[model samples]
Target: MVGYARGVSRVLVSAVLVAAALLLAGCGSDAPPVSRPSSLPIPDGFTRVGGLSNGLVMAIPSSWRSVDLSKTDFEKELEASGLTGATLEQAKTSLRSLQKSKALYAMDPASQQESPDGFVTNLNGFCQPSVGASADALIEIAKQQLTSVNAKVSEAASVPLGQGTAVRIRYTLPLGKALINGTQYYVPSDKGRTCVVTLSTDLTGKNALFDQIGGTIRPV
Candidate 1:
């Protein structure tokens, strides 16, 4: 089960970076200029994140805090997120991974308060070069990758996102005795890359909130 978790993590992290077969797409600092304060409709109880030269705009729950590893004080960020000790180390590792991939990351402040070693509900996004693969094809590749790792894939389809459409996938994977629920979106961008957004959590009932957040993703 630990292996399965590692596999799933590899698949998701790869999606944040290289994404097997598909070329990597950069975001964050390299993103195109977006309107000040964002022009997209902010969901109720959610705050819009990403801007300035970043290539995407997204909304996360108001209770969640977006992470900017480059500028954020790691130790302080973890404390504010209610993490400490080994959990802080784990989160620090995750944040470094996201930072290295140039991805945008966010998490619920109390996500790790209860289960110290459990998966934290979080959202992250990055981009991969389309390389001619359509959204449907990209999603299939993602599906195959997860299934290869024995992850249970429960959903895959193209869904509306912002002004365009994206391929969305929902899956569950075992981690020790727990199950991790995850949702991913492959959004084609005008910037010649496919933005891959992911929402992952241990909580099973956050899909509605995940959908609400994913709906706000738009290539800037």
Candidate 2:
């Protein structure tokens, strides 16, 4: 039930990032993919954002704002990214005080999405896993947490994403009279970083924006 989970995605993600940031991904330096075979055109209405400098890239509608780490922590992140070669546990604890943040690259109110209405989407990046965590392990962890409350989890599977692998976790959360469906694409890059792309709507299935954005991801 971990990935099947809804409201808790933010918390789990933030905690995970802060819990293991320094060890897994050391202030990721910007680098561009040398190939784009898995790449697809950016959706017609969406604009591509981010560049090699940020260490990742994606496409989304133009309305969203790129969230920034709290200004106070700016220098802190810079400092953490510089050090290397620590024991696994030390790197994990080092992230305890860190702030885990995500960016909302697209949000459009004008668009029409009902059912479990959804309007915003986010992209997240996590670096190498010293534990050598795989896509299956990621899916398994999410399922355990989400199943505790009897969340409906189905179509749990892993697919190759570029040179890496991605776990697709689909689930529904009961909200009184309505049920919210969510689709999460968690990809661990060939380089060892992880990218999580998610979409949740009160509606029944996938949204165009969601599908479109998924097309542009090269993953590795």
Candidate 3:
């Protein structure tokens, strides 16, 4: 299970969002009326996005332009992560396997002004070592890699996502004079896999797309 966490470790990328607050700010476009179940109402301008190779799909604000990370250092980072052919292929497979309402957007370390909230949020999937693993273990894995000062964890419990349940991880960090909060709702996926949806924002709590976004995850 720990090994899985290591591979799914980009959860740490979120730390970049919270940690930066020690320095300074708080943190999209258009598209279709992607029909959803009555229970899951997608807000206006929330466009469907996903990886072409991976079946991963999800709805993001249509106002937020599609960020193509493939051309960015993202690929280099993945390569440098020490993932070999088989492991890399498996990782790709797990993500592409997602059917609907799963998305990953590009996070630009350099440009923060382009995004509405001065933050980048994303959705993704990973192959896990154990499908039945506990939420605490996964959270701990991310926490160990995070260098947060006076971090406090809350709402660490199972919550419904789409047709399945996810471990909702909410935590706060004090960076410089700023208060940063991050949330990750993790779901175990098919054939020992995990899916993660993350939100990173300042104490202002300005983003409102997540609640509508959460409902689009189709039950596996």
Question: Taking the tens digit of each residue's C-alpha lDDT, what string does model 3 give over 1-220?
Answer: 2112334345555434323421232200011112223344356767665444332345656654333233333445434433346543443333332323234542223223434444333334322233354556666666654444456776566555554456666776655554556666565544344556655555344334455665564322
TM-score of 2: 0.56
**Tens-place lDDT digits, model 1, residues 99-203:** 644567677756655434455677777654445554455556677888766668899887755545667799876655556677887666655655667887766
lDDT of candidate model 3 versus the reference: 0.44
RMSD in angstroms, candidate 3?
Answer: 11.0
Clashes of 1: 5
Output the worst ten-in-a-row residue range by lDDT, candidate 3.
25-34
* Model 2 lDDT tens row, 70-154: 2343334433433234432443353333324232222233322322332222333322222344445556677775565455777
Which candidate wins on TM-score?
Answer: 1
- List lDDT for all candidates, in order: 0.60, 0.43, 0.44
| TM-score, prediction 3 | 0.55
